[model samples]
Target: MGKYTQDAQQLLRLIGGKENIAAVSHCVTRMRFVLNDPSKADVEAIEAMKVVKGSFTQAGQFQVIIGNAVADFYNDFVKVAGVEGVSKDAVKQAAKKNQNVLQKVIAALAEIFAPLIPAIMAAFVLVYLERFFRKISPQVISSVVVPFCSLVLAVMAAHFIVGPIGWKIGSAISSVVYAGITGSFKVVFGAIFGFVYAPLVITGLHHMSNAIDLQLIADYGGTMLWPMIALSNIAQGSAVMGMIILQKKNVAAQEVNVPAGISCYLGVTEPAIFGVNLKYGFPFICGMIGSAISAVVCVMTSTTANAVGVGGIPGILSIQPKYMGSFAICMVIAFVIPMTLTFIVGKKKLSMADRVGAGDSADTVDVSAEAGSISATENTETTELNGDGANTLRAFLTGKVIPLKEVNDGVFSEGVMGDGLAILPENDTLYAPCDGEVTVLMDESRHACGLTLENGMEILLHIGIDTVEMQGDGFEYLVSLNQKVKQGTPLVRFDREKIRTAGHPDVTVCIVTEEGNAKDFEFVTDIHAEAGKTEIVLFN
Candidate 1:
């Protein structure tokens, strides 16, 4: 199944072919398919495929999991099935459509405002325009177009798009949360928030709770929220430290640990949240559980902070000496519990690349440079292999292709005919590009030779720029017209320096005469192209 065609063929056959596929999209790991009838899929066969990692029914779709080479498999699947694809982000959005009533309401609010985004943007632009026009008229500014257009748009946007909807949602959540925190169930709310807050920091929405803490300080002179913030931070920091201890040799993890620790201890948890804890799923949960326990203790002991700052060591400094013992105990509990839990239950040792998620790249260098037509500085000829383990074309020979820019002839340089490789002769030798029949040969001039590859890709080798003008001097052709030649079989030999002395550039250009199929090849004019060696492009 490493063969893309075979993989596609098998996947289609096992899943009841193209007729059963309702929709399909691919992420980094899986080919997500919404099937007409998922029951028709041969789950066992799919898992058994060499390229397939596994298969699953997830989010109301049949998902075929592939590992790092999912992209290659997905492309083949599309070609074999001829189905249009949605993006990974779209797949995620589609998955989110299956939601509960409360989630639907919240999603609906966001969706409602989504269409008004353009109007909101207009309001901002209008304000800028108003400010720009204001300086031109001190008196007319009162009755100016700026005020009517900009300010009105801003007001309308705030009222309809943001103020009512956003304020109402915030107010509702605030009311419920405030009641929970201030009522007899303060301990429950404290624990719940402590367990959830670090996760919220991953989405960068923990700032919302900062407003609650500030309000608590303003109204009741203390916040049940502040204790959780401190506990959560310390716990998160300890969890990262534990991860570092576990995978001491993981450079990426170690690189993140120190900075993330500093950020968490300083009350800015973003670095720790995103860089460390959030990346490792279990470490974060361990931190949360430890945080929950510390939060419960803080709530029971009535620990408080007098001011607003990051609620770790900084917040503790603001606390009175009477509650110092409670704060110290909270810190110790938060740090110790997460450290223990993470060390015990967290993930196994990870590589540095895996720790930082550098292993997953969205836009990889899988495709060849699209410049057989124009390779920035030169022309490159590329042939792609489909990973079928039965490649049609191997390297004809190993040599570098010079950029077409170096070619002096206008017709060859501009690629008016077609795109291909240009090689500067190092040893004044030529070879067949593929298994082909030598259809045309200028045996006398020895400047160029033409062949028809087995796959019908026509090849024209121009030995040097404007070498045809030299007639047959310093050129020697080894093959005759209609002669059969294998790839890498030397076809021409000429004095490269003789052509240079004759005032012609020693750049040899290979062009395809049939059609502009040169675009299909990888244009690697910059790199040295080695015949029978370098694999420049891969395709069907």
Candidate 2:
């Protein structure tokens, strides 16, 4: 007999012997069991045993905390009960069989949001502590010292105090939302939710739907919510397509509208929503109307999704096999209604001034007067070029140079536009990397611009991730469209602090949108660079 043999025997007897256990597994300090009938297990008796520490039932599994000796206790218990131990996954699958609909929904929600719980809790904790620290600390060093200390304390608070409490609250919220959607008036609820979903995204409340959708899938084997969300994305894209058609004569408007529409169809909607639709009020409303109509159709057909896949045209793959036909019908409604409505409304609403070239209203640069005023002070002689007949591109911002792949935004990180590098900008002013003609400049937001170098390389300077939503609040465009610019010419100036205050990273990216004449290129990264004076990219 082992040290825990007698204790294990007692535990088995108290838990209704071998027949009560469907599957058993142990995780570090706990013995997890899928019970045949959880009520048959005497929880008080189990906790009273010498080896068991405490016990609780969760997600159809009765878990008994055994401290560090759980492995030994588990070994003897399985042998004494004459049952083979199963994998933890097997135990979880068996446990699911014992759960009722409500219990399964909660269990699924908990599992799905488990990864995000710590992050959500930490964000709240940090925000509260940061304000408190800034108010109390000495202003001289508060800018540096207070942030560090607040971060340390916030992490501790999140782990020790807030994490568990926040999880309970999140679970409760998910349950309530789940109940509302699956209630007697589910179809009406679906219509309301679908119509308002885009607005909810703006307020950040749409995150709750992710947890609820997982719960629905766990309980009913699929979710009706996700289908509506996918349809909404399609509607948003279709609206942009209508705008593109209306603005077909305006080259500058097409630059933003075409890409924003394509991105929306591929499941990324922010560009379309913030960059185009919200800027023009009617398109946004038309998309919302289209979404609601399709959502009603979705609920009527009882269409459901196996998972939250792509939220656009390709989202059909995520629908259940039997519901694919119904989902496709909903997709057509989403696409046609929004585009038709937007086109009809835009024809009257959009005027010649609204459809004009973006640069027409831009601050024009007088070549002679601005040439003397905006010249760089740095000496160009210090910068080096490769000896082997290679052309060099200098840094546009003074900062730590990093590979484009390291950027947080997927468009740059994944090289969707082209090869490039990024800078964690220490300063606000963006200078020309080479002598080029300004080819593309955003009018309203002024967050990004494009240049075609004398060497035929097309360079795109994007100020910050998602900064387009700022609507030119802290940005200034110094160069106008088609203007000739020499190396180190001041292009655009931005306020770094304003970008951070708006909850966006200030990593400026420089992309080679077109290789043009260059056959190949290489990026020099992981080093600090001086704007207008440091060579960062070599084209051969």
Candidate 3:
């Protein structure tokens, strides 16, 4: 997948002018274009263009497949269309508009946590791997446990990753009150100062509570550390709340309704934070408060020792019974207070009803403003027969089968997307075996493509197991835009990285007719099993 700057003018011209687009949305790889009429789309023309992976219709949406380069293209599209990026002043105005302290806090949390999902998941898998090895053998557990234990430095990870982000948001807020103070580094130093002061305060409060023989903590054995955590979290959550408000007021118009509220409620914070905005510090504070308060309360109630680690929703789950109620209270308070406040403040500032999702609305935008005359290129390819005599036909789904690795070797316990049946690869450059038009190209460039052949047949070619993340690094495409490729002509060069990466035998090649109309036919080759010769699979 190449990064062609999406000329808003070119794209606008191709999609019958932007007025033709009833609405626009995007998935991992494709832009979902909703048109008032499908005929309004110059499907063949757009397909022939080199930049598009392909196009297809699914669930009433006309999808234009772009590769991993879609984001850059999208930004380019916005630029050509004269669309504006979210502005800082707009955000400041939004924050100053009408938010309470709690709302601001949650906004901060969302910003800090959203970008750190990858790192967080990496840490989580480390924990799971430790548990898995312990289950396998005692010796294995003893050998790897200490190293993994070191990775359980969750607080350190949070501080390093989230703390900086939170401070930046705080500084943005603080600038309104204190003149100057712009750099993230300066804000972070200030936050660190606050954080250091908190612990001492907690100790003092605990001792003061226990005037008789130092019973507040030493005798009564109370750990006030939880409140300190709660306080920190509240601060960050407020920031996140502020960001949401800002984004709502400032980001692109149109509402993206999604099933995010419940997800965020369950502590899946990244979606809302990343999906919404990041400039505010409040949401981050709220999130931190929620986690920290819960953590501290759990410690105080259960007297739990951190032989491993704590915090996060999972940590909240692992709390002992004595502290469970207190921790739950903290969790609820942490999420709800900030979210409610942010929503309310955002609504008031924007002078609009509460928005449910990030701005993914079904309203039409002038796509032509972005995509101009770029669609006028050639697209004459049709469902014509190649020398190989493989007529272009649609592939329909029969049933979802398991990948070879999923059934036996067990590298991955779960099955991947698409019907996981095995098919043979064509012998040569797998060209357009049928007379259909190229309809889609995947972002990963590894698998999942669509072609609408002549005679109303739709074909989907999904490449190997979990190969999407490869992002076009291995595979190479041979055909150019609007070029006629006969059946058995090589379309994509498949690399064997998927199999090699798993340390498995690479004897198998699959040609699965995994989508529309083509599943009516059966597999046509055992020639693929041949030793040392290039093998190809054909279907009728």
Among these predicted structures, which one has the highest lDDT? 2
TM-score of 1: 0.37
lDDT of 3 by residue, 198-246 (tens): 2322122212211211112332244333333333334333435444444
Per-model CA lDDT versus the true structure: 0.63, 0.76, 0.40
Task: Please report, as a residue range, the 10-residue window in candidate 1 with the lowest summed lDDT.
Answer: 358-367
lDDT of 2 by residue, 292-353 (tens): 99998888888889998888988999999999999999999999999999999986787432
- Per-residue lDDT tens digits of candidate 1, residues 274-354? 546765567788899999999888888888777556566677876656787898999999989998998877434432123
Q: In terms of TM-score, which candidate is stronger, 1 or 2? A: 2
Q: Model 2: how far is 477 from its true place, Å? A: 27
**Leading candidate by TM-score:** 2
Q: Rank the candidates by lDDT, best first.
A: 2, 1, 3
Q: Tell me each candidate's RMSD, in Å, in order.
A: 22.0, 25.0, 24.6
The C-alpha TM-scores of every prediction are 0.37, 0.39, 0.26
So what's the TM-score on candidate 2?
0.39
Candidate 1: misplaced stretches above 4 Å?
1-179, 347-540
